[model samples]
Target chain A: MAKRVGMEVSIAVAEAVKLADADVIAAYPITPQTHIVEHLSELVADGELDAAYIPVESEHSAMSSCIGSSAAGARTFTATSSQGLALMNEMIYIAPVLRTPIVLAIANRALSAPINIWNDHSDIMSVRDTGWLSIFAENGQEALDLTLASFRIAEDPAVCLPISMNIDGFTLSHFIEPILMPEKAEVDKFLPPYKPQLWLDIKNPISIGLLGGPECYTEARKATDDALWGAKRVVIKAFDEFNQVFGRQYHVVETYRHEDAETIIVSMGSISETAMTAIDEMRDQGQKIGLVRLRLWRPFPEEEFLAAVSKAKNLAVIDRHMVMGCSSGPVGLEVKSLVYNSGLRPGISNFLLGLGGRDVTRDDFKYIHEKATSGQVQARCEIVGVFE
Target chain B: MTKPTVDAMAKVGDLPMGFTAKPGSTVAFKTGDWRSVRPVLDREKCIYCGFCYFYCPDGVYQDMGKDEKYYKADLDFCKGCGICAHECPKKAITMTLEEV
Candidate 1:
């Protein structure tokens, strides 16, 4: 049985992990991500969830503990944001290479110089190349659903890699929303107990994460890359199965009325919802615009993304993280390179906005549309709404 | 049991997932070639106290039993760190430069 209930998004994500029957949770409390681990610790303490809640001293130990537990054939999980994620960077890169199928929840936040704790994509963008299967959720429901799906996708024998489910901090993570909470039986039907292909067994021993001399280093890296690219198939299959079981459909690249539009606004995370509202308003006024929401960031849904924007003559690629000194933001760079390689010449305008908890209103989306369509958008990334 | 070796010619697809290898696979990778010096045992002064066997970092020194006069170094895996010579109470073992 699945029932819609009002719940905090972070708590809902924690509940989703419980539903997946995680064996261990090793996490340090950081703002935005703290509530999720807090709830998980409560669940473990109350005996509602039968899992080890390791209160690690730092985020680095949290991820390292997860790798050890996951390697020992446990379904492991953890959550972090911003500086916490940065601290886990070293272990984060090692997990996938060691084939540890740990599920990580990231509350996307702004990294610090002034030390601000707010919602942004800067945190996630920093570790974009860590070889983890990364996905974004635009709302509480998606965040919950993706958390469950990540465990399934990561533990699959064909895709034994770590996964990070990113939810915009404060905006999406701290918000209370009505989410369809799936029962344990339903979740069990969707995601069975994790069966690892390789694990630390005393009787039948195997060594993992060994030193790769130059002789085999390239081959090892190539093998991991192939596994990551191959994970897209498992992701699709898991989502399809989820649809069948839970009656909620999800796509790697979801679109909002972009089939016949002349211009498309590309965005990710919670800001896409704002873009959708703006698109609806523009449509009412008879402007030919739509939105393409990127749900899967890594193993970048190449063919699907190109197909989604193929008919559009103009594209407003909204990026929340500023890749300093680069010509464009991270998402913008990805889109430009993708389109260029695909031989498509769409006028793609990269807009950087809503950084460090700055509000991104519907008008901002409308402004981006105007800039993109007016053919005055520059080759350089535009920082929107900076105080003069 | 013999350790498994990764084929040098194996393709990317043929390699093991996660770069995992059989346990104790270092047995196949002989590190003795890395050594610039070798340990020489003087059976005459050796009291066979087993200090060399315990001190050798690579487990290179093997007990030759009471019937034999001294312990022996398994040169096939020894890296010639000279820990055995340093730890020998009888001073019966010495490190000698390997002939280039």
Candidate 2:
């Protein structure tokens, strides 16, 4: 059994990265995500971890340096949030195309126009098409566990792709909770030294970045798409192996009291925990309502999601970010698109809630469930807790 | 180009993802076929100044020793951009039409 210690979520993630023995950590400090990079810098400065802690000027350079370091066959890691992720948008796409297995910890935060430094899915949702393996952490233990697992998944020979472990800003990133800290020896047995399959080297010089004309551009894209889809198998295998080695198990779609529910509330991030409390209260009163949490966002887990929600007749999707001028939220849109042809007809009501970390209490979830269950919602999607 | 090198390029199917060759792989890819006009050097009026060598973006001009022939363009890799011809001070180079 691992020793349990109480620590801030961001520090736990940094400790996990330290145990993974990362060769390089290049990052820029941003609100909510600052503690992660700050602790990593201290590890390097205190000689606790032997690695290069590059304090880059901006997130763009941070991701660029991470790409260069990973291409040079180093185990590279970085952390960022909100605008920082937006700044590194160009390099984020390059990491997957170049097959550089760099690990990123994104403290999921709201994007700015009014300049809000709070938790939301807008930052993570913005990079939905960037072709990185995106996963969400519900709590501190998961934030730590997934950080270690990301390196394994990314560096896996079958799945040589970048990964993003999303920690909800201020909610999960700042929350202090008791978590099981695995020993270094236990982690060492699980994750081995990174052996790069393809790399930039001097001795065995090779030319990369060949010109992809119109004739070959589609083919290159096809290959990349195929690789990302194939990564799902490796992701499952890694989770199973992790469970076998360390006693904690995870699924693509985790359910709570959903065995024979008529209505299921779907969600992601830390709010899923709040929804669980709401579901428990609803179930005690025989309301027949349950909860479904999406653990994996990208490589979207369509089959697993369909199977998980198949038992429910109605679904109430809670989205943290609002897609302006859209029919539904991003997650709801994807879920609707996926289940359109599945032949399992179920009414999905999207409730766009918790923008910029708005207070979404148990009563709010109860309201969403009541509205979705009674089919009293006027549109397919509606904003909750807004002044409307 | 060597037979094996050309064979390898032919083996690359529709998608050439991260296709890497030797250090000087660029030498293997001939760009002369893309040229609509070729640089014709009037070596007789040539002054051995290496202006064309410095101006050619493709490194087309090759140094032949300082004895008599100072430099000449390697046409197999030249796109004939006319930079070298435009930069020649002595009017020793001219762009000639490459027939289809």
User: Which number leads on lDDT?
Assistant: 1
Best by TM-score: 1
Give the per-residue Cα lDDT of candidate 1 at A277: 94
Q: Flag regions of model 1 displaced more than 4 Å.
A: B1-10
lDDT of 2 at A150: 95
Q: Which ten residues in a row have the lowest lDDT in candidate 1 chain A?
A: A208-217
- Candidate 2's displacement at residue B48, Å, is 3.8
Clashing pairs in 1: none
TM-score of 2: 0.94
Put down candidate 2 lDDT per residue, A1-388, tens digits, no spaces: 5889999999999999999999999999999999999999999999999999999999999999999898888999999999999999999977886788899999999999879999999998999898899999999999999999999999998888899999999999999999999999888877999998777878777655555555545555666677788888888888888898788898877889888999999999899999999989998998999888888887888888898889888988888878998989999898788877788878888998889978889999899988888865446578887794
Model 1 error, position A270 (Å): 0.5
Estimate, for each residue in A10-41, the C-alpha lDDT of model 1 and write its tens digit. Answer: 99999999999999999999998999999999
Q: What is the clash count for each candidate, in the order shown?
A: 0, 0
